[model samples]
Target: MATKTHRYRRVTPAQLQTISSLAIWIPILFAVFKLKTGDTKFRLFIIFLVFGALVDSFGMIIYYFLSNELFDYHEVFQILYLWYECLFFVWLCFFFLNFQQKIVWRNILLICFSGLFITEFILRIVISSPNDTYSSFIYSFFLVTSSFLSAFALLRIAENTGEILRYSWFWILSGIFIYCFSSFFVDMLSYTAIGRGIWSIRVLANIIQYGFFVVGLLKMNKAQ
Candidate 1:
């Protein structure tokens, strides 16, 4: 859900470090190809990918160099990332609402969520903890759960239940759901001893998400 773990500023193995950095690009490359084929649906996803790449790249790598000279900028970048990620996921949830009324409610929820995000960001800085893991956990839990429910609701109302699996959005949402849901758990567990060091679940969840994304993107090609 966040770099709450500092992207494991602690991984010693070069192979794993390389793999972790590369994992995000898997979905980005697929999304880029989809956009190249003239599919506009993935355009927002493209932006999401690019933003994520920048955030993770700078936060995980560039920050290391920064620590040598300037002060570490934890409050802004990571906090901004957490806020953006939450908003994006919530908006993705909004995209799937099949009914106008449901969409309206989601809009209201979006506003509320935005306000909440702002509040959380401020709290993270004010709090004594290095990372506001608790507030972050709240965001991940709420947004991911809401998005999951939105997707589930779509499944319930879909006329062509059998064909639902063939749609690109379904798999994409499912991948996001699985990834974010796992992240929510990771955020919660981070408060305990079990959450010490780097958790493989984050890496595993990320790969699984993009794996489903590859399937989802391929389905988009087929649909065209």
Candidate 2:
């Protein structure tokens, strides 16, 4: 009797990169075509989306060129990308909060968060390895908290004023909330083998999140 053989197929980082690029760029293209030129919020959102897509593409190019020969360079690129992502989320959270609150408070909150992020970035650079679990955990925690808080604030504003379902911000916040919530644990355990194994799941979560972003952009465009 012949024995049966079983083989496992693993997903590659390059594949994840491709998936992420598609997830980010498809919505960006949709926003470009569907969104109007007015509405400051939508305009800023589109700008950020485009910038993010460009960054992702650039990272992929770097990875293709340097990953095999200069692994450290690839890692550095990834760390820089992560740092950029953190800052972008901080700005995004501030943008949402500012939309609901006073300008003075917005400025204050932005300053505070900017300081915190800078401090954390420095500490991560000084104290943690490039693949440090704690650094990823801290970044994930900040993103999750910011996303949840912004979502709650948006909900409160909607409750007092009008339908939350009708607002673009609501959908955007919902997407952030879902993405951060789903990835929180994975990020916390990012230094572990199990965490590394589940990266594809995180990519899928991001795809769903970006889908919500597209919907929000469409809704916002319709409203304008």
Candidate 3:
């Protein structure tokens, strides 16, 4: 009897997207890190970006190894990645809120949203699988809400400070707004026909969003 061998197939479009984005991100992140040596305001955002990139890269590696398995860990990785994504956006919102001199409103909203997120997370874990549609919906909703709230807060600050266009956070919030606005609908209809049609659109939105992030980092470098 002859031994059997398996040949790996070409990468999928999603995997290609991850690889391409990382290629763009690595150099930009390095430049940003060098420029933001002592900047504290963007520390958390930078950490999140690097971590997200690593996770995405690891996910692609897992895909290559377990692509043929019936009960592989790829779905688990995806769930964990989605959870991190939601949590990071929440952290970003809190970071933005810290800019406000008065903490009362920020505290109230933070408490409420945090509670809601915890409750939803528990429900998701107890009642659904990691790959549940409802879990994705909930996570996407949280991200979208956090992004919009952050954008609103940044705008309020810009209005009061009178140099909104010059602020790096303005561009960051703009990117978040574009990505989350498009993603909100995608998440809602992720299992539907419309979702399939909008998949390319979502990818385009993400690319644009990350482009804004690069632009924001460049502006910060100039400002410094």
Candidate 4:
């Protein structure tokens, strides 16, 4: 009975939910890539996406091993984590820019983000000191800017169609705003008193951030 209870407690509902959601996101991102891009780019982007996922998986595995002396590669995992993060932004740029439009605002916005994307790539390679600080700022800027743009786009659609997505960009933007601002301070706090390791607060922040996107995606799938 004690062993049974321990087994049940080890695999909690939240972990199960996160796994299920991530599983769903994988297929959804693949489908979106298939429908939106050329065969070559879609395939290449998927390769990078899956590779990034594997890097994250490997980091988790390495961390597990490190904690138990099963193996040790914490430094390697840190480097891979940086690569994983860089690829995520690159993937986002590819995903959006591929869906081109003649619309003036869309073109303008893409151009702006394209410049920022290039900067991020360069910074990823060149900026070495206080790497986390720079990365956090870049990511925060991306999230906050993307959220504003999404909100604006939704508003434009609502104006034209008289129907907006339920919970829609509002929820997504709120999530972005919350995390972007929260993470700025989280980074600052890490430099100060927190000692700079992964904390529960960061975990919770990420959950809320991704949860917002998941809910928005579900609503979109339902609407379609």
TM-score of 4: 0.47
- Candidate 3 per-residue lDDT over residues 48-110, each given as its tens digit: 676667666666665556454522444444455555556556555555554555456555655
Error of 1 at 76 (Å): 2.2
For model 2, the run of ten residues with the poorest summed lDDT: 69-78
| TM-score, every prediction | 0.74, 0.72, 0.70, 0.47
Error of 2 at 138 (Å): 2.4
Off by over 4 Å in 1: 1-18, 36-41, 63-71, 125-133, 150-158, 222-224
Write down the lDDT of every candidate, Cα atoms only: 0.66, 0.67, 0.64, 0.48
Residue 184, candidate 4: Cα error in Å is 3.1
Worst lDDT 10-window in candidate 1: 68-77
Error of 2 at 89 (Å): 4.0
Instruction: Say which prediction, candidate 1 or candidate 4, comes out ahead on TM-score.
Output: 1
Q: Compared with the true structure, what per-residue lDDT tens digits does model 2 show for residues 68-182? A: 5554444455455555555555566665454445666555655665565555555545554344754675666766766676676666657654777777677887787787778
Which candidate tops TM-score? 1
- For residues 1-224, write the lDDT of model 4, one tens digit per residue: 45544334554434543453355345346346344433443345345445545654654565445463523344444444444444443343333332335355454655665565455555544453335565566555555555454444445545654445474334444454455545545554554456354344544665576566555444443233
